[model samples]
Target chain A: MPYLPTAQSFLEQSRLLISARPTTTRITTKYTLPKTSPPDPSKSKSPPPPSSEPSQPHQPQPPKATLTLKTYDPISGTCLKYETDKAAEVGRLIAALGSCGRVMAALPAKEEAVDEGAMEVDAPVKEDAEGKAKAVPKEKELKGGQGQGQHKGGEKGGGGGGGGKKKKGKK
Target chain B: MATGHLSTDEFLIRLATLFESRRSVNHGSVFLTQKRLSPHDLPKAATDTPLPPSSPFPDLHPPHPLPILIRATNGKSKDKRKDKIKLSTVIQADELEGFFMRYADVCKAGMSGLKKRDRSGRKAKGKAKKKKGASGGGVEGEKKG
Candidate 1:
């Protein structure tokens, strides 16, 4: 199976919508009518058999609701859709998306737009507003900025940018 | 760096990549929206006609159906107006839950938490640098004596 795209790419290029379909229950009942015989002069009236009795009574079956996640890249007009009846999977996606939403909300509006090539090494040397803001902190860190060395050292493996920043601090 | 604790930009960028990767494969769980011939593509008479009542597979008809768009087999060009199509992306529940767990910590703390952590980390680095500077000065003095 192909591994999922890393989280970085998802945040940069897509918007998502989540929706739930309610469960529905189906119950069926069938009734059978009594068979009537034509009355004849020679035949005495036969006792009427019970009529309109239910022939089949089925128990109600309720199907669980399905949860759907729709992710689309507005720029490219491409979409990827996923759906599942499993509750566990639904919950996870909801939680992850919720967290992402919260973080986005907390961010400054100015940093919201990221340059397409900012993360790529060969894309271009141009830096956007967000990039310029990030550069200020790196400059301070270079001049004996705060934070533990060992802790930051351990983080070198966490992300490419983090690793590169630490190396500059050391120099 | 915490396994799931990433700054806002990093987190979002990574997520976009993850979504792109998921789109590469189409299976039971992940469905890439497909383009099928739109009703407009059919002749006027065909568009007006409904399915015959005696159709064999009644169950195949859904009460509510998803919109379909035409697929381009070769490099057929698209007509913006005539080819208007609707698209949807559906992710299976299991995968959604799996992702939630993977990024649980970051999601729980949110961006503020990361910023707080970054502040504390900076303080720690400063202290460490001071200690290193003191020890280095001592070593140089000892060598001169």
Candidate 2:
């Protein structure tokens, strides 16, 4: 099995989000969610991998809420929900969220983003501001010179493709 | 201008390499289950071995602790002895970011507490510097008089 991205990477990339909101155990940096998501619980729960190594001991199954990390295709309407509890595996998804260039979606989050049954909304979802207005804050934040060097790296990771752009186009 | 997009496959590859270079904090308990033996779990075989299967797995918050169950699927095998069948250690996930995030408050509290102490030390230093400045001013006044 491929080893997970080191604890340091996740620690570095998403440290702000994690430290900024200590109570939040799970956070989704959705590049884009459709305007009328109508979130489905069944679809969200990732299918466990086949029981190949039943003899292996101490293979704990991930609990429901802290378990899923999905990326939905706006065009095909497919959701790629990851299932492994491996720090390396799930950590990749978590790190991806930090690295992803999350532009504001045209639509705001609904009361029911996903039927994550016991998944508590750890913090209030930020209200979607007008398109251009949202840009102002990001630009000002860029001016503050916080991790501006990483911005170049963002181009290589996320800025190259427009996952959010595609999702927004469909909505 | 910041512009790029992440395809899922691409992101996975980048996570393996780019993110690996940075330094991470030690949460201490992560190494406990990291190199654990998943195979050779049969109790008959295990009891003969020295190390007992990992007994104490860490508890999780937003709590996603997967149970470590060692299934005994032998037909007509009704062995009730606890030593005959060993259960798995109760831990989950390959990556530990979630684990760290779960205990972030503890780490944050420690970091902020250190910053506060550092600030107090700086204030004390500033006070000493001011005292020296006052003595210099007194020497200058004597010369003027």
Best candidate according to DockQ: 1
> For all the candidates, what are their Cα RMSDs to the real structure?
25.9, 26.3
Quote fnat for model 2: 0.00
Candidate 1 stretches with Cα past 4 Å from truth are: A1-6, A9-113, A116-171, B1-117
lDDT of 1 by residue, A1-171 (tens): 111254333322222211111011010111111122333535647643435224433223222233333454343445444443433333234333433332222222222112222333111121221234455535433432233455467676676686467656754
- Docking model 1 quality class: incorrect
TM-score of 1: 0.21
Give the TM-scores of the predictions, in the order they appear.
0.21, 0.20
Per-residue lDDT of model 1, residues B43-93, tens digit only = 578558654547453322323322222111111136543532222222222
TM-score of model 2 (CA atoms): 0.20
List ranges where model 2 is wrong by over 4 Å: A1-171, B1-103, B109-116
